[model samples]
Target: TEPLEKLMPIDGYEDMPLVPLDIAVEPLVSSISGIHIYAYSAKERCKNPPADDLTIDESASIMLYSMDSKFGNKSLHVILNEILKSADKNKLEPWLLYLKLFLTALSHLPSTRRQVYRGIKLDLSKEYPVGETIVWPGFSSCTTSINFVQSELFLGSAGPRTIFSITCYLGKYIGNHSYYSSENETVIFPPTQFKVIDCLNQGNGLHIIQLQEIQPCFSHLHAPVFSSISKKPSSKLTFNSVVNHNTKWKQRGVTLTKHHSRGPKPDCLYLPYGVYVDDNQTIYIADHGNNRVMAWKYGATSGQLIAGGNGSGFNGSGCETNQLNKPINVVVDRRRNHVFISDSGNMRVVRWPCENGTNGEVII
Candidate 1:
């Protein structure tokens, strides 16, 4: 009842371990109704004078106090009280409490396992799925190949048998339209009974047309022509002199020379597609037939081999710089300072850094 401090410092207690007074009555404070209690005792002799004063109930109460003090039952009592209050407010039945505890422990065990299993299953399915392979469309024949299609110009030649200049429509309508009779027909020179010789773009909308067998032979005529659209003249007798003086043609300063007497004078020459002129006016020709790319300065009559030469198959650098097999096109990326070639036969696009001829890389 009174504070346990008043009961401390017993006589002949020199052998007793010092216990805090506040902890001595902890077991008594925590004692539940009808629970047994005990006292602290260091000796086994019950016949001692202090033992004679100890009642069974008092001794048991003391023992219970010591046990509660040792285990810090005071803090545990606060936690237990809060738990009981929450349970009561929620009307949580004993069976529900047991169920919740069981589920909580079980829930933690397999949730992680289930998630891992699902992830593995999804990964496996993605790794092995059904799909299809596709084949793309491509050119089938070489007969239709037309190389180096230069600008088309109307040529007038002398002679009564000179293939009378006639424009025929193969599709929809069929008829012989004589160039000399059609007023809408574009004529670079007057039809004054003279034959046309050479024609070339003279910048602007004017073209220089040379007349052959014009009495003085080689008379030149500067006539305006409209290439953007085809226009028909209103009269069949008078030639339309309408000229477009604003047209500009890309000037690719490439000149070809017959170096060898070979196949039926190549009607046309094929250069790789996308070949461009650099700012420095360098021309890169993807000569697929020769299996090499030739670089020529603007207006140069000869070119230096920049890539593969007239070889057949694949190899590395130098004279063995591999064959170009059927390289269909060539392009230059000035910004990237690189050149790209469509190696059709190899089914890939090869790239080479500008100015570096032998070293190359493939881009699919």
Candidate 2:
């Protein structure tokens, strides 16, 4: 009895060291490239005649070698086979192919990930978020012979022969000469043409009026142009008077209430083109004349700076947050504590948080 073994030289040289094989009848298998191979066999058994059939171990070894050579030559074939097996289990073929192509073409660089994430976040935000709106109340014309009940209310004709009244809630026609006659008038009073400038709400439903002569200006002018009518002598008359009228009647011929002039004529009187009132009664005026928004605190007679106070020029946001470029109107959202400004010249709207004024959030 002998153990199964193979013999070969130490190297592929002809005169290399030779080793003896333990099993003499075993075949020497060689690859086509002349590389030597070995086969394992069992020793001959005298009693059982060494079972004539090929052993399972020898067959398995040969099959495994064949398979290893085939797979080693075509490595991609095995990979494809594995992928096919997985696809069969998952029932994914066409979709998997598409995904593979997509992944291949997608960004592979690590640096782009941040930019992509930011772009996606921005796109998602735009899909559902509601942006802010800035509104400013622009002064179109001077309303003399009118009364401002509150900062929000006005009672007077906007123009000659056009009597109207405005409250914070709504506006109504007192009487327009084009539509109503004297007999149709609700109250008996002299028919005088005047514009209501400001209104004061007294205890007895009494309101005062500041009247100035009217001078026409360009129809497109959003701010009151003093130069357009300054040359007219009739426009020089300034009357301060109170018009006591019931909610139902037109009252007249009342004595005027004088208000003492405060401060030495403002270095510059900024005629507010737009106004916004916050919860604290702080008035935000888009002073177009000053090219800035002025803040008049609740009890203060003078206005402080809010936004765009450098005499109307476009520049950086340093100390000029939410600078208005020819601002025309302003609206305040008391609920959100935000101010909306219509930067008409810039053709955009800008917003400012009511709590902070330095940084403006541009909504449009």
Best by lDDT: 1
lDDT of 2 by residue, 1-364 (tens): 0011111111111111111111111111211211122212211111121111212222222222222233335422233334333413242232232222111111111111010000010111111212221111111111212322122233222221122232211111112210112211111001112233443333333333222222222221111112111111212112111211222233663211122222222223333344555556565665544555556665565666655544433422332444565554667676787777766544467787655476566677
Candidate RMSDs in order: 52.7, 48.1
| lDDT of predicted model 1 | 0.31
lDDT of 1 by residue, 107-200 (tens): 2221110000000001121112123111101100001111111113222222111111211111111001111121122111111222334344
Clashes of 2: 26
Full-model lDDT for every candidate? 0.31, 0.31
TM-score of each: 0.28, 0.26
| Model 2, residue 165: C-alpha shift (Å) | 42
Q: Best candidate per TM-score, number?
A: 1
Cα lDDT, model 2, residue 176: 20
